[model samples]
Target: MPTTSSARLAALTVAAVCSAASTVVLSAPAHAQSVRVHDIQGTTRISPYAGRQVADVTGIVTGVRSYGSSKGFWMQDPSPDADPATSEGVFVFTSSAPKAAVGDAVTVSGTVTEYVPGGTSSGNQSLTEITRPKVTVVSSGNPVPAAVTVDAASVPGRYAPDGDSAANGSVNGLPLRPDRYALDFYESLEGMNVRVADVRVVGATDPYTELWVTVKPDENRNRRGGTVYGSYAAQNTGRLQIQSLGRAADFPEANVGDTLAGATAGPLDYNQYGGYTLVARELGALESGGLHRETTRAQLRGELAVATYNVENLDPSDDTFAAHAEAIVRHLSSPDIVSLEEIQDNSGATDDGTVAADETVGRLIDAIVAAGGPRYDWRGVDPADKTDGGEPGGNIRQVFLFNPGRVSFTDRPGGDATTATGVTEVRGKAALTVSPGRVDPADPAWANSRKPLAGEFVFRGRTVVVVANHFNSKGGDQGLTSQYQPPARGSETQRHLQAKAVNTFVRQILDVQKNADVVVLGDINDFEFSTTTRILEGDGELWSAVKSLPRSERYSYVYQGNSQALDQILVSPSIRRGDGVEYDSVHLNAEFHDQISDHDPQVLRFRP
Candidate 1:
């Protein structure tokens, strides 16, 4: 392997002059062809292949020690297409070239000498390279400034990135290959350029931006300690072409001087650490540079609240709400009342009572009874027939359940009692007038997808409106492939319309709120960081429960290591009356623990 032109020039001069003395070319021209890189193939063994000069010797650098004081013994690259061996190579490193990035690509011209696994007792001809190997630094193609390199400690995948830290015979562990292929390579970045979320963001070298990309391992492989590679290190630099977004222009918020991409022609292959992982077989920098903004601040409280949870999808036999009914019952003990989401509808043979999705409500009712809380019942759901029925085991998601002991019900403006007809509107959102005639569940289904159930609940002689909401998921119009027929982010216009409707509904809720005491609960499907939450929380309305904490401590639950704030509680100013309401989160199953529901039942307290 030859290093950069300047590096090899010095080495070549030494080789030429030293050739005449005892140093032979071993050029059996035909045999030499075997070392022609492209001609070399098959497993690379130091023994049988001894004295056999092979080209393209690519293998893991199990042992990286500066041999004798002047040189070091390391393995050669087994070629991009070849397999890395457990321990190959007895090459000599001559401090030649300014230190080679270990997990780098090396082309060595060598004569192998067999050495025992750990070296023989008598020091037999363990494989050894007579000539010092030259090298070429590969690039990850990440545009980085010369001032900074990647932070190796946070590297997500395996690889001893430090040029000084030497390994004897094995490398570090690797990542569980992403559902999609992934990897981390090294690159000698030139300037200040870096790619973010597929988009290449440029830099002016003014306000340095350091970016640390992280990909955590699953339970099977516990490689902990934030695998977020640093600003720009050999371990952090690499040109990965895994369907990455290219160009500063291609990506929104992208800056100046960003490299489009210098990625490999195709997808990354599974690097052999233990299993599959995406990493750079070889990588480097693209110039420009990096950025890293560690924000510890939490999102401030907002007026509108939204949340999501798996709840294991409550069913007839499953009393999710009822089983956890204690939490809600205690919630009502506060100044404001709470809204229910994911209330299952009876989904069996309706007339005869064959347990179906609609029948799930029984679980809640039963649980409530066992707890002996005020007779709280649900309203505002779909008519048994209209709730996407037709084919089989019913899976209806209704929103009902109220506590009569806490607040009195009031029809919104004007409304006849609801029916079991299965029309889009089940009982229409039931209203519970809080103290002084304030609605606990404030706004009704104003627009789109079975809008939230709203009403009033009385607390401390003061009436407060409560609005329960469950919005669409940002997993991005998935069901669209089938049910929606046309994906919204795609061609279908209505899906987009539906999305707008959801947004509009949120707007309406904020608009009609009578006081700052409006508390919004229930699952809102959207996360705080997303556009949905932002749009819904509109203009200093609802106060957020989670955002009030610091960012690192903000997440309520984690999925695949990505901590997200899905289940949320937002209180209006009225609860605080200017001071903001008191709050706490019930994360029994969310500290990386699995529980009754995917979403935690959040709670808020106020003095009303």
Candidate 2:
């Protein structure tokens, strides 16, 4: 459930250290046979000698993590095995601060444990660690193993081998093919020291002192110097998360297009959040790429601009109101209608049963007006307390902000959190039974999730139906780097149902009056090519506008190191059948360290 990169890193480290807490320690025999690191880490994902005690394991310490709860030292065997599938390095987990230093020749005797980074339920690959260590300094100043260079040529082009069908798509039992797949290649060097020279920073440095770098610079490179994740097949093998083992304050703060100049070498560790990670022991200096925030051109006179921005849990207490206001006024070019997601209640997460967001919305509106933008009025139904899921008591919901000068909101009565809005023919025109109403809020698809908010607007004597949605996030889904091949996306079931319900509602509106201008937009939390999207675009009911751009320019969010489309805008056939529509996924956020929001706002302009 850790959302941020730093949180996941902390969680993984905590889980790894605590994995041996409940383990029953088994002492080795008096004359146990000496074992090499590769003997413990076999050709498979799981360690061969797991749950057994190994004595007299000889290796030279390569890196030492003395800080934090996960205090341990990474050691690499100078003498390696002939098999390329097995790793030469291993982590010696000490309950407290380790007494080992880098480059020290040491002998360790401990119970070999297959520590799953997140947990067994996470489907994350396990780390072969030696727990309950009995360390002895054999000699001083012995040379460490040479760091393996991880460049474009070293990492295989293929991502991972498909799992065995009989075992429910799990590759844990499969033999490691280091030369064939990138996942296998990384697993082959699981605990080994690896280096990447002058790697480009694809993911910006987050607050948790972690960033992402790619050895394959040219693979799916975007205009903004990011690796575009177009589909499930292309996992961008070279993208690896980098976390410095040094001080957090000393960690280099980098932007998306920057580069880590010189060699950044470290023990390759598999994390719960971002699969393969290089925990930097030899840190690199940050070289700026001069990346800057972008601005979109203002909407034309006849075009009504609509945009969607997930403000990252905006509330009255947040100091980001001014920055978000500037992003709306400057970067977004002041869209006529904007759908704001994650707008917390007036009390934020205080859990005082305050469901109203008037103060929060009012502060943002005031900031916009102060920033030379129009005084935008907002419309949204307050959800029943704790019914909507977000930050525990935040009560986050989708709210619509419209500029009255360009468009007018058609307010109808009898709309609330539990009320379901229906489309009806009024004077031979498509109309909502209750404007600013919930779309099938009672449906099971919306349980513990935000319901779709549908509203009617008048623009230049034409009626436009806009539905703002914040679908269920992909929280419980296994990541792309999961041990299971292709990974399981269990969270998609709810999203699939959500998409079906939205598509059904849109169909109802179009059935009432053909050629109705309906714009559906928000943080969909799924890829553009996903089944959820395909369901939303059922038959010919709706089409995603982000796909109108080239494949490289279709991303509104960045996760790990891949630029992906999570926030999107889809329009009905009436709106898509013309040449007047224009869409822009404004690159204001998601690529910089000082972003006001985590998601980039998407704008769609068209004549109704």
Candidate 3:
């Protein structure tokens, strides 16, 4: 359940007071008529009796949430209605700690209100709840409603039906179609006790005591036991999030490919973060799948290994420097050059107008040497204070780390935070006007976002232009379970513009020297098949090397049970057609319970 704001809670309280006052003024006894729980939860996503007062709604308490600001209790009628479209259960909001307990038969009288989680603008479906409840204990120790089994067989293959075209593409008005759509199937069982048997974990447990599992064990199963999200049409309906109703510290820590042995029963809930979740009253025992981290083979002596890694907001104060250094040294096999994203300023997030990162980069270099790796030299242009869109005051930016023994950074001088770098001809060949410079930093597309960092490096006497990027994130996009069918992706507009800017820069370098050895890599923050990638690979100027791998092995990140790609490495035609190139999406993180970073690194080795 999503936390209701104090303002919204006050509004609800006022409305409840007004409704109670109306009941007192009406002389007719018909206003106090009783109704079933299914009547409150109508066939549609919203309640037909919303904002109206109902009396003597009876049910057995199946679950009680005694924690958090959204304190509530779920109750279900043992004798369900004949219609499958209507749910037999509903949640009663108590504002404070709920006094109801499991197995208690109670008669609740309250105003039926449709509360939208995350507010109405968020596109989330509304939860049918009874607010400002007046409860009457009818009996004690009554049997709780039998839990409904929700497995692959119970959920539909189709994700959702297209919304009614006349209603602005919204499915809120459409009747429930539980047999055809998975979203509707879950909606039909809202606030009801549900159970899943022997589910496989697809998302690792996080600090919030939440993890995701898939009921369909084989749905797009990869070799590492994660479900691959290939396309928008395939939303992977079997994936569901699980949270315990018990103590947060008691929740089992689980990784991808692990198993929840036996039945984990709970009430189906709709929350802000994850749509349909099981707040488990009976959590299953964790069984390890014996999954282990993978290490890539060392790069050949004659090959130049380039890698991209998003060290999730690395700062000098962080304790994971040793762990990250070990990952780069052992798991990634010490690449010749690495594009590190999210390196914070010296005073990490203090916001005192500090924009330098010499201390931060120096610490990482020292840690790498301590971990038995090469002594690396770095190059990067720090962004204006708070100009980059990240943790405010962190001043996150991209930096390149190259082993000085294997590669040399070409220093051209005169590159600053706001200065735009351009391509120029030097000795009848392509070269950067400013070696470590920003690409179109003043453009509106990069406003409040990390600008692309372009640098010149000489590997084995051959010049290579490397552009590191970290695009704007998907912050305002509607989620997969949005009430609006085929939810809108508003964040892609900015990313598409950002991609065009980089593509034009890449084209400029190729225009001067068509056979230039250019390596464009970093956390692109978009899928390999997205429009952003299409724009980056425009007119055969470049091609993403990640596509060379098998579709099941292309992902570098996992979210909500879907293994998908957000980090990529693209190369020019010269490098693509060069003497043999090897690409590996090293699986060192993103699938474990304890992760140093949320993103796995990608390494590409080729002869320049």
Ranking by TM-score: 2, 3, 1
The lDDT values for all models are: 0.35, 0.90, 0.88
C-alpha-based local distance difference test score of model 3: 0.88
lDDT of 1 by residue, 1-608 (tens): 33122222223223211333312232232243234221221222222344454544444332233211223434333333332222222344354432544454445555432222111221111222424344444532322211112222223343322211232221122211211111212211100122223223211111111111222222111111112211112121222221111221222222122332333111111111111111222222333323221111121323222222335345554535654654444422322234555554454323443423434655655665667655555445443333332223432343535445544444443221232111112134322322112121122332223344455444435545555555544433321101111212321232234334434433444445435255666555555564555545556565566566544444444332233566677666555465544455554443211145555556554455
Candidate No. with top lDDT: 2
Q: Candidate 3 residues 80-107, lDDT tens each?
A: 9898889998989887888888999999
Model 1 alpha-carbon drift over 4 Å, by segment: 1-310, 319-336, 348-359, 371-375, 383-395, 398-400, 412-450, 476-516, 576-580, 592-594
Please provide TM-scores, in order, for all candidate models, with all chains considered together: 0.44, 0.97, 0.95
Model 2, runs deviating above 4 Å: 1-10, 15-32
- The residue-by-residue lDDT of candidate 2 on 1-608, one tens digit each, is 54344354555566343655423222333334579999988999877677777899999999888765567889999999799999999888896789998889999998788777667778877788888889999887877799999999999999999988987788887999999999999999998999999999999888777899999999999978899999999999999999877777788878898999899998988767688889998877899998888899998888999999999999999999999999999999999999999999999989999999999999999999999999999999999999989999999999999999989999999999899999999999999999899999999999999999999999999999999999999998988888789899999999999999999999999998888999999999999999999999999999999999999999988899999999999999999996689999998889988778889999999989
